[model samples]
Target chain A: MADPAGAPCVEVVDLHKRFGALEVLRGVSFAVDRGSVVSIIGASGSGKSTLLRCINYLEQPTSGEVRIDGEPIGIERRADGSERRRSMREIGRFRRDLGMVFQQFNLWPHLTVLGNVVEAPIRVRGLPRRQAMELARACLERVQLSEKSSEYPARLSGGQQQRVAIARALAMQPKVMLFDEATSSLDPELTGEVLEVMRGLAVDGTTMIVVTHEMGFAREVSDRVIFLHGGLIEEEGPPAQVFGTPRSERCRQFLAKLLH
Target chain B: MGNWERLVWNQRNVLLDGFLVTLEICAIAFAVAVAAGLGLALLRLYVRPLRWPAIMWIEYCRATPIYVQLMWVNYVWPEILGWPTTFYTAGWVALALQSSGYLAETFRTGIENIGRGQREAAYAVGMSPLLTFRRIILPQVLVTIAPSIVTQFTVIVKSSTLVSVITVQDLMFQSQRLVNVWFEPIEILTATAAIYILFIFAVSAAGKALADRLRLRYGLGT
Candidate 1:
């Protein structure tokens, strides 16, 4: 049942992340509505990927809270007024609701494309093999990779491999899909195919949080765009507002370098 | 009867029995080596309390001679522990104990060869660590080390000869017995060496076939 209080599908509050002395994310926060696409754009080393990682609990925030469906992620707030990280089992179960597509398309190399897509449903969800295979076929079809279902990841082109990865994530039926520069590793010529699949998903109203440098995709497909600079959100608004008329000097200069 | 015909007629069955015993020792020792070796590798890599001890034991086994270890386990261990130790038991125990270190090193190397992203990908799919290890990591490890394990198996087969010193009546012991009885060291030794070569070559061939099949099935390489 939907909460009457109208909580967003994803809420990240005052997130901070540090690796040793290097503070990568400094108090960045955002909320994502149901079935909306948000893109985070920034220059290299601007902490956009870290922010996405924190949202998925792939990287633990130094101090902050993330909520999925108005429930705290990975942390149990006890009556003793101390917060403790949930057990690995709890985290794994919670993570099933969020699918992440990596830049390297980390498909299980030892399995066929269908096997990669069906792994979570079969292994974690305990779906029957017949049912899982059917679901996998549908997901592969969605990505236009039905022909490559029996093939291995290495046999596919970089674009095809990434599309299979997207299908693999889609098989989980996650509440939100997180793309950490999904197209970054593709050849310049091959990036468009992967982006096209992404655009199709966006049109179908898939909720997504993409950390990317694809400025055109952000400007065209995303409902909102967040511009990060030096571990902070320098600008955030509708894509037209943020991309057309960036507010911060840092964001403006970054955009100038990127657009030109 | 001709001399060679007489020798073959008298000694063929004895040599066959000895060859069977050698194979038995190798099979048992191989099983021991694989199980113990995998345990040692995992303990050294993951189990904190036993890590140092596993490392030290592996180093010790790799450092000392198997011949000496066999002698010690056969002769000294029983006295120290106040237990019975037989020739059969000693040969297997000593050979497995020594070779497990090598197998452990092989496992560690294969495990290192796997990319970190493999585990991360599994974890991202909401798999428990146990599931991740079983489904994601263990298969790759088995495929990676299949050839090395075959090489080790052949070595163990040859090392079965060491048991002859303790009167286990394996291939070497029986062959030496035939030499004493017949006084035909050159011919008998040549035949024995030929048997060993045949056995080792068969094992290597079978291992290669199995490895190739696995690689192709897993879509690893040509």
Candidate 2:
């Protein structure tokens, strides 16, 4: 869906997340323009996943803000200069606009592929069952899993399950799709199919923020590349500039290590 | 053999009547236990202010002996609360209290066993915490804990025998009445024990079969 012109589809301002004594994200900030793909690349524990999770308020940021479609989520700022966490219902309303795909392909094992795709549309969006089914079929076809609609996730391979997961998110028609290492758990052979579906989404102008280790996909598909080191953005630019000639030594070294 | 025919077969009508009462009490207790147990477990897990009270109740039910609980509910509850005016009400209520504790713990474990990722996934799709619990968590938990739930039902049936002490006239009460009438403790007592054993065996067997079928049909098992 098109966002109003000139407004970023998603924005994060000074996002900082702390887990008790451990501060996982420190002053991280970014934005995703509508119809653009941004890839966040980093080593393990660089807070890439945490940043993605905070965008959806799956893990609340200790401080700072995340906004989707220009509306601040999870925390509300009152006129008296007080900040209060929004109620879960309020947060849920905002979350419905952003679809997230997990690294683990966390499909509900009890539901069929079609059921998984249609559940939120019927329940959260309150679409009638027939309409939800039609939307689900279209999403299933987008991921090329229409033939496996009635099959349970347990019967599918890792790649097939991940595609079904992508379809589930796509069914929501979220403003921006967030992928948290969506194919990291797949076998090397199986990663291709899942990535192909994501590539199709990217080509069709879906706004996406991907936290990933897939260097090739990041370099080729993403319009912009962000390199995260520790808990902050180290280097970011168009993919060619960031990958070919990184200004930061750490970014260059990380890319070299991965390339080797 | 003559003793058997005279004591067991000859009094089959009375024994059947008593058995019907036992069935009624057990069924009522079980239904209440399941509903209350789920409520208690949810309160403990989700309701911040009431968590301690729910936990204390579960502990009390689990710790008290069934015979003691039956006696306390039958004698003390009517005096203190001015309710459960009949012995039968007291009987099922007491049985339900004990099993609800065990069932609450069973349900808690089942809920905890679900992966955190499952919950996050539900939330990501915009389902509220309550919706997630009902649609995503509860279905899987029920499938995973079907065997444990069946075991709790069997426990309820076995513990139900304690209600007879409060003059509820279940199968145990009727059989003991026959023993007191004839004063031939041997045939009546042995037959009563056999009947109790056979009934419990049948219940557990049927419960196990149903649970296994559910597990096969809906479980994560491949």
Candidate 3:
């Protein structure tokens, strides 16, 4: 379902993050409308992962606010205008509404494929084991990995592991999904399987923020494309305008080198 | 000459008594070490600032000889506290604490080796930190560090001999008494060494077999 106008699902306002002396995200700001796919593309160390992490409050920002569904993500401001950091317990509850898939498949190797999908729904969400297993089966089916449920993650191929990772996240029924280079670790042939799963998510209208290097996927699946450079949003627009008629020399150079 | 042969032949009783004591120490120390090590490893997992301090504690215990720690626990702890600490309890406590340091370092390495993504995936699904560790992180750690943990356990078994210094009457202690009374140092010492070697070999075999079973069950290997 489409959200009403001016009701953004995610909003990052002047976010700044620093590690020692290096500022990884410098005044980064963006808003993701509900039920839309926004792809962030950039070279390595361009703060793409940092931005995604900041959205979920995984990495606390040096200064700025992240609001999800109009609620502040990680801080509570009091009547005195003083702010308090959110507790881990509170953050965990907030994260239930958001799911993140990493570059690595990140399946718990000791657990079976079904265990990986069933664990969070049962433990975190407090669903009954029977109901959680039912949900897990449905998610596995969506990823076309239902038959591999009893197998361990170490036995799966890179493509299959990534798909299982996707299924594990989907079982949570998150309102927003964040992907950080989700297909970068796989071989060319394997990358297609993960990308296909992601395409399926987009087609199903899952709200998503994808950080990727796959230009074609960005062109095809993204409703808006954001190009970040040196920890700043260098340019952003619809794919047709950004990819076809680039605005900045950096974007054009990036596109030229990448497309070639 | 016949009488002398009979005296030495009765060494089987000594071996049996020592074996029981050795088992007691190893079992108690291993349980304590794993429990304490798990706590320290979780500290290392979340708090980067605590990592070095935890390392220092582990290294300190490892660097000081186990025998010396046993002596201190037996002789010094009661004196300092002005309370009753029995030799038996002291022996187990010293060994357990020493093993804790080594096991803590091993567990930390296992937890760190697990990719950050694994924990993130758990977090993304809204898992509490304790739940995440219990369900996701700890299981992977068990698989990743099983070999090292088993090796350390065998080492703990051997180290139990040090408890003899604290008058624990363990295998080595009994061997020493037999050596003193018999005046057959060469023969008695050799037998003692042989028994220890045999015991350790059995433990090593058991550990390898356990690891194989776990790997097969978890599908970690083909």
Each predicted model: what fraction of the native A–B Cα contacts (within 8 Å) does it retain? 0.62, 0.75, 0.77
For model 1, residues B1-69, the per-residue Cα lDDT tens digits are 465566654678988999999999989999999999989999999899999999999998888898998
Q: Where is the poorest 10-residue window by lDDT in model 3 chain B?
A: B1-10
Candidate 1: stretches off by over 4 Å: A1-5, A79-82, B1-5, B8-10, B81-84, B213-222
**lDDT string, candidate 1, A97-123, tens digits:** 888899989888888899999999999
Q: How high is each candidate's TM-score?
A: 0.94, 0.95, 0.88
List clashing residue pairs in candidate 1.
none
Stretches > 4 Å off in candidate 3 = A1-6, A78-82, B1-11, B40-59, B176-191, B212-222
Q: Candidate 3 vs. truth: CA RMSD?
A: 3.3
**Interface RMSD for candidate 2 relative to the native interface:** 1.3
- The CAPRI classification for model 2 reads as medium
Per-residue error for B151 in candidate 2, Å, reads 0.9
lDDT of 3 at A248: 86
Q: Give the Å shift of residue A74 in candidate 3.
A: 1.6
Better of 2 and 3 by DockQ: 2
What is the TM-score of each candidate's chain B when compared with the real chain B? 0.94, 0.94, 0.87
| lDDT, candidates in the order shown | 0.89, 0.91, 0.86
